[model samples]
Target: MRWLCILFLAVLASGCTAAPGSNQTQGISQDKSQQGAGQATCAGYTFASAEREISVLAGPGNAIGNEHYQRLAQALDCLAKTVDAAKISSVRQQLDRLNPDVKSVSFSAVQREIEALYNAGNTIGPEHYAKLDSQLASLGQAGYDISALRQQLETVRPLAEKTATADNPAALKDLAAINKLPECNGQMLSDPPADLGDVQEISPLGNIGVPGHTLPTPHLYFHISAGRATTNTVPLLAPGNVTITSVTSSFDELGKIDEYSIGFALCKDVYGYFNHVKGLSAGLQQALDTVPCADFTDNPGNRCAKDLFYPVNAGTEIGRVGHLQGNF
Candidate 1:
């Protein structure tokens, strides 16, 4: 299944400066001074501290959590205001490598690795099982919650014992099927959700150096600015006839405002989501009221209604931007 995302936030302009090519120590001092001056330009910015936290988390054996990832995203947003474009690109590359959730490394790869390890001997002792369990744990920490996969793997002992051959063909085949799962892979949208005229800017799906977005953002960011000012007066329309499957409400610490992310299924095995929404349409609000909310684990004070069947027609306004300089 395919997914979509929309992040609503004001874009920050980048700044650059050249250091002197004289004495090495003096050049370092000048660079530090320049960086401090640049930081001063953005009030209440935490790019420096956030960068340091990311560095620590990226260190060997450090567990990277959702909070750390959020801080990294926020830091990158702040960094855009003071760092050069090239610097941002470099940081993105570094983050892409550090992030275990990068698309190039699929969650199926973990399953395949475990399958291969089991097939090698058609057995798993305590040590081998522990190692395999750690791998699954690491994948969970990376944000893909595959509790079902874990549960299946837990039956490895019995599955292995029933097999006569060294290669557990049936088990391996089952693992391979995960790659074809709708959530793992799906078709892209045939058309844009909104008309070009409706959106001020449309960011392609990929790495986005912005707040609330990870290194490799999976969703598009639509900017609906009023002239040069970032305002939330524009209406957010549905791309296709879809069922609103979920809605997440979170506190955006950076914006100091509450935001909503809506997830919908365009069709069977095709899904999309939008983030940073300030307000929900009346229909959505009614649906949201009907469902009991559960706490979102990624961030504190976040609530989510994960199961819903609210259907919306194509071109329907499901939400609106409701604040000045607020992210949708």
Candidate 2:
């Protein structure tokens, strides 16, 4: 479930009704509040301690499709290149593969070899000093491509991204091509409904204004986006042919309030990740637990016939997104 945020700041109205007989009996709350009104009643959203209205900005989560997947993957590659990413992945693999199987091979000896190789990632090292400085610098950005073609099967032989010599630079070119391959879109995770064989179990989770609301499907999307920065993850809502019904977007008060009515859903048997799944936080786990799921196939609960339930973790709790209890 996602948040349908509506900001109410400036135009909020206040009313002063008659107080009780005794002024002292009717305690005046000097506290000020900005209530949302002049439209559909505020859709359900908990208000924190009062101060001023906080801006709520959120959008549907999940990759739109192959197009979005490719774009996001390219963006990640762009970030990696900025950090000399291939060299970084290669050097780490080398250090990780430092085998101590050779008898009498001390950690210091392996450490020195690893360090020497790592230094080359930043500059032409003592071991590989024959190349011209400018040429060596030009070589690294593409030096990690290994195969003549993209999409080399790792099972055949690990697709290495480092070349042994400047004379041998296939690794560098191969790496560049591989990263650009359509199949290699580096989306955190992308599984389209088109990929499903049979999708069933669809239910509405009620309305948030005209456009914003939640739906339950047998297979829902699972994703997470969090850090110090405000993150948005709407894995459950896949992007496809959306049926628009109504929408509201205008500036009320000093903040912007936008709403939409989109009607579209996926085939159910909801697709999602468990708490133990990677890229989840403890708070996220708790949020997932609140969305109760039942085996409609064997035992359907007394929710409106349309409710789509999900499996809780081993602890027997329901699943949720971003840790909001129940479906939004």
Candidate 3:
């Protein structure tokens, strides 16, 4: 969308706020003695320079593309290596406990209940329960076994309450219900631009400010439909040797969100936030190794959770978006 162009231009023209310890290497100079001795002097990266490079690679007629990805990989690889396998395992286990993937079956069942409730002429309160009971009996009498349906309704009761009254019907259908769970941490991104077999219509208002409103701080939308699709929770490799700050999941079922505006932090700002990553594609992994590493020891305080690690599963049949939070 043209908005993407506008957003990028705005970001380029007005650089984001710098994070603490962001410019640790600003005045750092390579000792000429080291050069004479053939020792390598480490240099740090800057968001402005990265943006400038992206703008140039974008060219006058195009937005950032493959070259940009290469640059991004190199940038991430440049960050310091703060975490090891143990740290990665810890982060992965924590994320697993949250289990952000919405159960499609549960979401679909709740959607049906909402529709049936609406059709049954009940809004909320005891009347709704009564109607549900009646429907359950009818199903049982028809040999359909209402027990499973009843359990599903019980599981989705809280969600149904919000969806029934939400102003944005399409946007709230499934997400409204799932966002309340402890796992989502009150940070559900947004409905997939496409229906996950729940959201009904796609009007202008529903799409406006959609995923943008749901974005948290310091995240990037790493849309990866063009990349390989797998059925597992794969590693979203560190662009550099940064630490593992925090890992989160995006609820874009079917990857229909395509692209959206998101708050972003420069790699420098997020440097050292996450540990070194594994399981990247062969090309990306190789690219990461070739990139110079950033020394974050000078910027320890600057390390924080400002990036979102979004990985899309091929089994979900959805395109993907990675939300990288900018330090700003």
- Top-scoring candidate (lDDT): 1
Arranged by TM-score, best first: 1, 3, 2
Q: What tens-digit string does per-residue lDDT give for candidate 1 at 160-237? A: 231223454433332332223346244445444555576766656663452323244444556666422544456777
Off by over 4 Å in 1: 1-195, 208-214, 226-231, 296-300, 322-328
- 9-105 per-residue lDDT for model 3 (tens digits): 9998766645445663332332433232232211333433433444454344332334435444354334213223343343333323322221112
Arranged by lDDT with the best first, the candidates are 1, 3, 2
Name the TM-score of candidate 3: 0.17
Which of the predicted structures, 2 or 3, would earn the higher TM-score when compared with the native? 3
Report, for every candidate in turn, its global Cα lDDT versus the true structure: 0.54, 0.24, 0.31
Better of 1 and 2 by TM-score: 1
How does each model score on TM-score?
0.40, 0.13, 0.17
Candidate 2 lDDT over residue span 1-328, tens digit each: 1232222322232124344654643444211111221111212212221001111111212113334334333433343433344533543333223212211223333334333322111112332332222222333344532221111111111112121234434334323333332342232323342112222222222312211112222123222322212222222222332111111111111111211111121222111222111122343334434533311112111111111222222222121222221111
**Which run of 10 residues does model 3 get worst, by summed lDDT?**
257-266
Best by TM-score: 1
